[model samples]
Target: MSLIRHAETSAPNIFHGAESDVGLSEWGHKQAGLLADHLASRGAEAVYCSALRRAVASATPIAHALGQSPVVIPELHERKIGPLSGRTRDEGWGVYEESKRRWIAGEVEFSHPGGESFADIDRRVRPILDDLSKRHKGGRFLVVVHGIVIRVALTSLLADRTPADFDAIAIDFASINDLVHDGSRWRAEALNLVVAPSPARPVA
Candidate 1:
């Protein structure tokens, strides 16, 4: 069996996207180190991350600790939110709600003005997952990615989950959700783990 977890990288300066692809915010950097320390303690190997800078940066320290470079997986990139990509969550209310409704209604092909639907991402991410499961059988892997991408991928891997499930799965910053692929089936190990803040760095 292989255990995989969806981990959200810490703060990355609020939707800067292509412009902010260089690295993390101050808090994000600290969070990444903390995540590394935590994963190192857990003895994790075969780390994976989105090619996007934030995710790569987040995975780096941990990969270094494990003596491996985080594998850059483009298929693990965040959902293409299109016109909504660069906007703050507050500014994208109308489009967000509408898209949520479409997803909830099972309209898989529904897309935003110039973006992708959950269906498109599910298609792109599935093959990568299938391959990972086969290649990394009986191991543990760390997958650091974006919020929506994590949710949609989880839904795709689990049986009978739909876009509505997306509404319920919350992926917070530096949070970890675990799943296990036992060759025959994939099972949820844990979901949405909020790491207790280290005493050395009080959360601001």
Candidate 2:
């Protein structure tokens, strides 16, 4: 059997918490439960999460459903946003237009004020991917991590896209992306997918 790689964006996090232990917000809790149900339905054998609370909480319900405790990997943690970690989108440099342009241009070399560049994130996540391949061959795994990390991983694996193309891969909170690892290569199976929202409102 081929290895199924399910990667998820962690729940929405509050911009609070000290440098070491930021956690999920109230909305994140709700998102985590929904994501749990989503991942549970896929029936992964091993549930893995980043060291952050948001990722851990996001993976918890699914882990329970599978009767396994989540395996936490610090390497899976979100890319460090540096001093911008708790700042609002506008408060950060390259907030709106320029950032998007840079991203689409495949430039991962530029750094944020106190944070890292896309290349930095790629470096951190690459080793993790290698480890997963070696340790979990022919198995299904769910990785609960962050948006930037997803982008970096995709940038590394995609056949026709540069890091800049990652700008268009919008991974919402708790959204899931799918991939597969054959013996030697990794392939993306799908991009961001949201669970269909219940139809209780707007109709055509």
TM-score of each: 0.85, 0.79
Model 1 stretches astray by more than 4 angstroms: 1-22, 196-204
lDDT of each: 0.69, 0.63
Q: Which ten residues in a row are the worst by lDDT in model 1?
A: 1-10
**Taking the tens digit of each residue's C-alpha lDDT, what string does model 1 give over 29-93?**
67777777777877665888888887887788878988889888877777776676666667876
Q: In each prediction, how many residue pairs overlap at the backbone (N, C-alpha, C within less than 3 A)? A: 0, 1
Best by lDDT: 1
**Candidate 2 global CA lDDT score:** 0.63
lDDT of 2 at 184: 67
Clashing pairs in 1: none
